[model samples]
Target: MRYIASQIGRSIRIVALSLPLADARDVSQWLGCNANASFNFHPSVRPLPLSLHIQGFNISHAASRFAAMTKPIYNAVVRHAGSKPCAVFVPSRRWARLLAADLLALAAAQKRPGRFLHARPDLVQPFLKRLSDKVRNYVIPAQNRVPSY
Candidate 1:
């Protein structure tokens, strides 16, 4: 995490969303807070708390074709990761539907044996009731809010 001075007299915690692999040193030197933050550039170790977010997919429904297109991406991701892997993000109801559809497509594309891993959320209950059971279980629950008068 990085910190920056705030106009409201609070320190803001910052984390870079992503940076090019080539500019790693410059980003750390400039954004890192400690004097010896330079040592973070060492090549031998993996970094902690990395996050990846893919956005802008319609969340209400997942179609068969879209699911087919995404199967390769998911397969590639799985092949690159370590064993005992877990996914942290939640997809909207639409995404869940899409993912389910995608998985079906994946199953169709390949004629051999397969294993499925579903996404899971840390939170158990959600405020919204209209979402599907799969989505509700897999996503961070929304907070119930009273409308202002």
Candidate 2:
């Protein structure tokens, strides 16, 4: 991410609301900028709520907390982001499959039809397609780097 930012030029303006303070500071340090560097485009820093903390799919604590919520993850996501595309990140192939199954179970129960995109779809089995017909088996990975403007 810092490499991509440097390519555009130094001093990237970041809105790190979705990031923990450690992550925010790391990003700043990697970019050769002071952590206190502020940009007018940035919103005042505030703590993110639980729902946005889904980056680690294999985290039993996070998953369990999410599971215990009165609103299912699927419903909360669909409600908060109504029809908009949503992205959930998971580390590793095993966690990806497990998280996919958990999400699909919820979606299936709700009878929600949606597309599943895989950067390396060939790596997954045919069973994944059964979850959704509009699945894109292969897609070039999107650049997740923060931009400097």
Candidate 3:
């Protein structure tokens, strides 16, 4: 992400991030510039809420938390996002496939397009076979480094 930012010479703003034993604020700080350096520590240094969402899909805690959320949570997310495209990230195919079905169903019903991206789509047969072709597969670039690290 930082590489992309540097390439574009634009400031990066993070809306949300989830990682195991990682600090989003510290990451933001590391990537921030001059006056906006403080903004890096807390992506939301401004009064407004940012929209970027990041998470480690395979983390147990994240999975447990997601499990605890009721369907209404998903509904609320879709509702809040309105017609914008939504992306759900998963570290593994098992969870991605499970969630993809539900999300795709929601998108179909809502008439919105949602994406199910996985690091290794080949590992998930169901995802490969059942997922809409519109779902994209993403592989993090090997050299893409974030100051957060």
Please tell me which predicted candidate would have the highest lDDT against the true structure. 3
lDDT of each: 0.45, 0.47, 0.49
What is the C-alpha lDDT profile of model 2 across 23-52, one tens digit per residue?
Answer: 555656665667468332222344433234
- Candidate 2: residue 26 lDDT (0-100): 60
lDDT of 2 at 79: 66
The lDDT of model 1 is: 0.45
The segments of candidate 1 whose C-alpha lies over 4 angstroms from its true place after superposition are: 1-4, 9-69, 81-114, 117-149
Relative to the unseen true structure, what is the C-alpha lDDT of residue 78 in candidate 1, on a scale of 0 to 100? 53
Error of 1 at 74 (Å): 1.9
* RMSD in Å for model 2: 13.1
Which runs of model 3 end up more than 4 angstroms from their true locations? 1-23, 28-49, 52-67, 89-91, 106-149
Which candidate wins on TM-score? 2
Range of the 10 consecutive residues with the lowest summed lDDT in candidate 3: 140-149
Kindly list the per-residue Cα lDDT of model 1 for residues 79-111, writing each as its tens digit: 654344435233476665666545444544563
Task: Give the runs in model 2 whose Cα sits over 4 Å from its true position.
Answer: 1-23, 30-71, 91-93, 114-149
